[model samples]
Target: MSTKDVMIWRSNRAGTHYVADTVVMEEPLEIRIRFQDSDGKWVERPLSITMRTPGDDQALAVGFMFTEGMLLKNQLDKVTIGLENTVTVHFKPDVRPELEKLQRNFYATSSCGVCGKSSLDSLGYTYETLHLAENLSPLSPELIGSLPQKLTEYQSIFDETGGIHAAGLFDWEGNLILSAEDVGRHNAVDKIAGKALMQQSLPFNQHILMLSGRACFELLHKALALNIPVVVAVGAPSSLAIETAERFGQTLIGFARDGRFNVYSGIHRVDALVLPKK
Candidate 1:
C-alpha cells in the first residue's frame, strides 16, 4: 500500500485530458512500547504516532526507538504488528526504558522530526564517539557523485509516485547495500537503521549514508546514532547540519549530483585534488 491511484485532469499547452495518477500513500502509524515496570508489572503505552508511508512499519518503529535512545541493540525482545497502523515493541524484562526522559510531543509529521521536541537539549542523544584513523582509506569524489544515480535505480516507490524521499546505505565503492523510501525523509532513514539493527549490523562506521533531499540536523543525528561516519545528500545542507558534522568528526557532503559534490566537513575523507597555490 505504498501508493494509491486516482484520476486527475492533466493540463498541457495543447489541451487537457483526464488520466490516472499514482500518489505516495501517507498514513499514521502508532508506535507503542511494552516493558516491565520496576514492580515486575508489564506496561504498554503509546510512544509516538508518526505519519509515514505504509510499508516498513516495523523497521520504522525499531529505528525510531534506536535513534531516540529508547531501545538498544540487545534490549529488543520482539516486535509485533498489531491492528492496522499500530506496532508494539516488547523489550527484555531487564530492560526498563526511562520513558520520562523522552521529551517528544508524541506526534510527528512527515516533513520534520525534531519539530516535535520540547527543547533543544532533547536533540542530543548518547552515542559512541566516532574516531577516524589516519590510515583509513579516503573515498573518491567520483563514487560520491554516482550515489544518486545508484539510489534512483532501486527507488521503486519514488518511480511510481514520484513523491517519496529515500535513504540509501552504500559501501566504500559506492555500491548500494540497502535503501528505504517514505513520504518523510527521517522515516526512510529509520527504516534502513531498523533493518540493520534486526540483522545485528550495528555501528555502520564503514558505510556511507546517502539522502535524496537536503541534509538536516535530525538526519545527521540519526546517522550518528548508527555510527555512520559519512553522509551525502543530493541537496544542500542546513547550517546546523554542518556544525554537527564538524563537531562529530563525520564526513558530510551535499549537492551530490552531476558527477560533482561539495564537501562541507571532514574533507580528509574525500580524495579531492589539491589546488595549486596562487
Candidate 2:
C-alpha cells in the first residue's frame, strides 16, 4: 500500500490556503519474466517497467502480458509477488517467451499505452478474436445507463485523486464483477484483466466493460484479447475504436450516463428502440 495524502496549496475564489489533499500513489513497477534458459536454469529477464498506482502490481503485469500477446495459458504456471516495486511472472519449465516479438518499451507515459510501437502496419493484429455478435444478448437501455454510476461507486482511488482512470467489469444485469483504477486507463484495465485471468475467467463475452473516459483503440484491443463483447464508456469513442469494434462485431457504447448512451457499433447487442414522439 502507498500513501494517499499529499500536501498542496489550493487557490480558490475565497483565498489561497494550504491543505492536505489525497492523491493516488504513482510509482514505477518493474515487471520481470522468469523462464528457463537453454541449460534448464531459470533466468530472470526484465520485461518492462511501468508507472502505476502501486497496488495490484501482479495483475498489471499479467494483464499487460496477456493483452500484449506475450503470454499463453500453459506458459503461465504460476505468479508470485516480489518486493514492493517488483512483480515476477514465472512460466512452466519447458515454456519460453519469444522475447523478440515483445518489443514495446511501454514506459514513457502513464496514460498512453502505445508509446513504443514499432510501426503502424503492426496495427494489423495477429491474434484471432472470438466473433461476439453470434453469442451476444441484448442489454437494456436502463442497464447500460446504470453502468457509469456503478463504475463510479467502486472508484475509491479516483474519489481521492480525481485524476485517475477506472475500468469496471459488469454482468448483463449491471452487477459489478470487479473494478480497478490507475493513472493510466490501460493499467486499470490490465489490473482487472489480470485478476480475471488469474481466476481463469477468460472469454468475458457476457460482461460489459465500462470505461471511465473516452474509448480508444488500445482499450478495444485489450477487450478483444479477453473476448469481451460490450464496451460502455462514460465519454466519447474515437473513430478508430468504433471501426475496431465494428470489425470484431462487438458492441461499443459511449457517452453513457444518466439513462442515455450512443451505440456506435454492433447495435444489435443493445435494445435501442426508438420511442414515439408525443
* Reference-based lDDT, each prediction: 0.87, 0.83
Looking at candidate 1, the ten consecutive residues that score lowest on lDDT are 125-134
* Model 1 TM-score on a 0 to 1 scale: 0.94
Clashes of each: 0, 0
What TM-score does each of the candidates earn?
Answer: 0.94, 0.91
RMSD vs true structure, all candidates: 1.9, 2.6
Error of 1 at 35 (Å): 0.7
Cα lDDT of model 1 by residue, 1-278, tens digit: 99999999999997999999999999999999898989989989888899999998999999988987778899999899999999998999877887774435368899887665553356564334454333568988778888999999989999998999999999777888889999999999999989998889877888899999999988988888888889999999999899888877889999999998889999999888879899
Point out the worst 10-residue segment of candidate 2 by lDDT: 118-127
Candidate 2, residue 184: how far the Cα is off, in Å: 0.6
Predicted structure 2, TM vs. truth:
0.91
